[model samples]
Target: MADKPGNQTPNTPDVSESDLREMKVDELREEAREAGVGAVSGMKKEELVKALSEARSGSGGDGSGEGSGSEDDLGAGPDGGKIRRGPESSKSLKYSQEVTSPDEEPEREGRSLVTTHHEVIKEWAEERGGVPATVGGTEHDDHLGVLRFDFGGDDSNLRHVSWDEWFKTFDERQLNFIYQESRTDGNQSTFFRLENPGREDA
Candidate 1:
């Protein structure tokens, strides 16, 4: 129905020129060879047509116009469409320029895991601060609460106080974790777990 790409031959039985135009490029090359159009690859389009005409008309000669290459000749495999994968950089494990050894208390540890700090907080408060927490009411579930906060630029401090004591002393409506960028409603904020020491049932 459509004129595709192809070459014309000049050494075969009589064939119409319109038929040659309708053949595909690959198909025309094949026709030239079958019709004895020698050195078909060197001929120009016009020459190929002329040769094919002469050959088909019983005048023998060799000239066929076969294309040099095709669109599919270059890169038609998985590499053409594939996206390669590479190693991903990790987001955690941030490191500091300053370095400090384990013996440097209240100092910097350049690249340290955080779990060590939580454990240290629990231990130090129990040993030095007597685990004293000033919390409010029976909210601590019988356990004194130790709230860790980092008041921006004031240094992070773990305050071990009773839940009831804290609740009573500070208004829950205006309290917030020191490190949080946003303000917490004092009435709605309290991180302490006030435990009932005398109760056994849930």
Candidate 2:
């Protein structure tokens, strides 16, 4: 059975490829204590693959390939609610690169953000399929940049990357519609991060 957090969410280390390779039953059990292992526990490493398959056989949360909850469930509850909007979502958004602090540069290490984009991301997006995903970037003192994201463009839900490659691009000939995600207001309070913080409406 999966263990639930009881007023405490333990910090789970990132499951590295190296760690997965050498996992033992006892080690897996410990991992379960940290992050519940479910049916994947006690199986020989070889059996791990098959057990994961069984767990996903309508036993886990995601019934559809998309994820756990439905569209209406978005913004409702943290667990079942879909906080991150997908490309196909009607409440999707568009992205534009903005360098906030002049002193802020892209950090290649340390702090990495799991930001989304309007299916317009280039290289990584095209290579990984048109699906929306989070990618890593280097934040530095002089250049803290974000991958531009938005909705509607080339296709019903597609994006464009700028030629600079570091920035997002849109085809001059084609245009549709774009919307940005709304963050909450106030500090310590969860506010939707405005695309351009300097922008007044932002």
Candidate 3:
């Protein structure tokens, strides 16, 4: 007997790899979580798809493959989960390397690095006297909105904030920081941009 069009077994995934690929990274992560694919917070889009596929097929041992470790493997989240990987924002600056730790250095000058590491982000901001900040009047009921870095610029609407506050909001929103250490000419550069891959407008 053939299964009905809308009826499928519990082990059979209704979504396909191509369908998963078309979905945003955040959406993929959510699907992974709902499917009982563990350690998905740090997974990239491809990884999430693979994990989901494996889980659906019931062939992924423990459903903990590569890059599938507890949240502490990367950075601990406020709720003991791994630091999330945001979807690449449309407005994100170009980055050549992905730095997971503060100790990692760029392979060349003017190279852009993307990271969600707290230490790495803090170091990068401090190196150029950048302070955590938020856009004025963008607050939502005591929650900071539109995070930014204040480099002593003339932007009077920027409100300086504590690192704790900034990071709390950062993780809550699942954002990635794109930045460069120097210009292509080897001069100090203050180029940095924050992106929330979870947002359609990000």
Pick by TM-score: 1 or 3, better one: 3
- Quote each prediction's TM-score: 0.24, 0.18, 0.56
Best by TM-score: 3
Local accuracy of candidate 2 as per-residue lDDT tens digits, 74-123: 22122121123333322223332222211222243222122322221221
Clashing pairs in 3: none
Q: Residue 6 error for model 2, in Å?
A: 25
Segments in model 3 whose C-alpha atoms lie over 4 Å from true places? 1-95
Q: Candidate 1 — what's its lDDT?
A: 0.34
User: What is the full ranking by TM-score, best candidate first?
Assistant: 3, 1, 2
What TM-score does structure 3 among the candidates reach?
0.56
lDDT of 1 at 101: 18
- Please, what are the lDDT tens digits per residue for candidate 3 over residues 43-128? 56788788887777667634455554433243433433223444545433343487765446789998877777775676567657
lDDT of each: 0.34, 0.28, 0.68
In candidate 2, how many Å is residue 160 off? 61
Which digits, one per residue and each the tens of the lDDT, describe model 1 over residues 67-106?
4232112121222211112232112212211111111232
Residue 157 shift from truth in candidate 2, angstroms: 66
